[model samples]
Target: MSHSIAIIGASGYTGAELIRLLATHPSFEIKALAANSKAGQPLANVFPHLRHLDLPDLVTWEKIDYSQIDLCFCALPHKTSQEVISKLPKSVKIVDLSADFRLRDPAEYEKWYGNAHSAVEMQSEAVYGLTEFYRDEISQARLVAGTGCNAATGQYALRPLVAAGVIDLDEIILDLQCGVSGAGRSLKENLLHAELSEGTNAYAVGSTHRHLGEFDQEFSAIAGRDVKIQFTPHLGPFNRGILATAYVRGDSDAVLAALQSAYEDEPFVEVLPKGETPSTHHVRGSNYCHIGVVQDRLPGRVIVVAALDNLTKGSSGQALQNANLMLGAPETAGLTLAPCFP
Candidate 1:
């Protein structure tokens, strides 16, 4: 039997990516779509790239009967998602693609998000949806909070090293580059064609990016101590993908060996052979994460690079992966699409 699913923020890029992936899923059915601003429009109209499929017309959340939805993907913005999800039926499983529930401590959330959490109770129940790290928890979770795209990419590079004690926790630094689409489909002066094309600039520098919260939370838990990493994100002119380069104090062979062993069994996350750096173009439009490890000239340091489609593996693809676990479907179903090439 196909599980009935609803997408609450259908007009956004992540929401549309979900529809693209789930369109061929064997046991999942798209029963409803909600995008208040585009409520009366057809999904095809909102996202022409997905016009080839037969899908439901968009509607306001209030117009849908929640009793019929078995699962829901909440892709709304930060504050709006928590407010909307708090009112959802208790039985509906959720995979949230927002920064709302990723941080467990309300104080920490407020510190980073600059707003008091409106759904503290529901926040406590949301499993951190990093997939590989929390598979068991996600399979049983009523709500799963997706990680930030940059956080996800950086963790793919450093989490295993931190856990295996192969890297020095205190000296970690992540310099990441993200495509403009990660900013969302919303209009911004900087994202304009004449402005964004053929140019790149760094933003959220000096520990200001919110994804640092997720890194601190997950890495600290893995290392059994407080682990803070310096993270800086840059905006590239491309439309999708994230590439994170991490500098760590560690032996090259040990870091490579540890990362290889950690992802040896993971179907989606791949650890490339040593000295082979991965490019974002290779994983674009796919749910795959490619990681590369290399030694730095400095004796005790190594550089780790990780890449993935910010919208796919970083967000929507991950959301679908968690949903597959929650719904008891094959973990790889609807996610076998290969990466696009030039």
Candidate 2:
């Protein structure tokens, strides 16, 4: 029998993406959708693009019957996710797409998120949902914490190198370009078309981005010490995708080899041929992460560029991938759609 699922916070981008993917899934059924802000409205009215699918109408979370849901995708905002997830039935598996439970250390979560973690106990149990790296943990986890999109893209480019001791950990720099949609569906003066269309500029410079916490936690765990990378995320004019160029101290070939060995069996992460760079277009609208490696002219320097659809491989797609593992579904089920390229 197909697993019945409920999507909390179903009107946002990640929530909508989850619905789009699960709409055709063979073994997953969408039974409930909760979007408090747009409750009682047809999902089609909130997102006309999804009009074709037969989906449940949006309702407030209080009205959903959680006992009937075999799995839940919690796509609520950060603080809100922890609050909502804390109340979910233990029998219901969850893949949280917010930053709430991604950090294991409650203090660390407060340090970056500026609020105390309300669900400290649950936070301790969440497996970091980087499907390729935490496959075993996610398979047995009831709550899987999805990584930040920018963080996921950066890790795909450098995790193997960090784990293999092939690169100097102290000198890592990740220059990222992300589409405006990463800001979510919220209204912002900067996100207005008039302000965002004409040019591209970097935000979260000086290592101020919140995803840095994820980098610190994951890379440190792999390296057996604290690892900090220089990360600067730029908002691009496009609608989706994240391209991260990582500058590190290492032999380009060695770094590439490490990445290749790490993801050889991974179905979603693809390492391009050496010296060939990846473009956002190649991974747009799909749960694929493409990495390319190149040697910089400067001795002992290497550049690794990784690209993925921020909403797909970075968030909802990642959530679903983990959910599949938690529920004994094929890890790649409902996730094999080819990228949409122009």
Model 1 over residues 1-342: C-alpha lDDT tens digits? Answer: 789999999999999899999998999999999999999998878889999988889999988888999999999999999999998889899999999999999999999999999999988989999999999999999999999999999999999999999888899999999999999989999999999999999998896789999999999999999999888899999999999999999899999999989999999999998999999999999999999988899899899999999999999999999999999999999998999997
Q: Count the backbone clashes (under 3 Å) in each candidate.
A: 0, 0
TM-scores vs. true structure, each candidate? 0.99, 0.99
Ten residues in sequence with the least summed lDDT for candidate 1: 42-51
| Reference-based TM-score, model 1 | 0.99
Model 1 segments more than 4 A misplaced? none
Query: Considering summed lDDT, which 10 consecutive residues are worst modelled in model 2?
Result: 202-211
lDDT (C-alpha) at residue 138 in model 1? 98
lDDT, residue 65, candidate 2: 92
lDDT of 2 by residue, 1-342 (tens): 589999998999999999989976889999999999999999999999999988889999988898899999999999999999999888889999999999999999999999999999999899999999999999999999999999999999999999999999999999999999899999999999999998999997895789999999999999999898899999999999999999999898899899999999999999999999999999998999999999999999999999999999999999999999999999888999999978
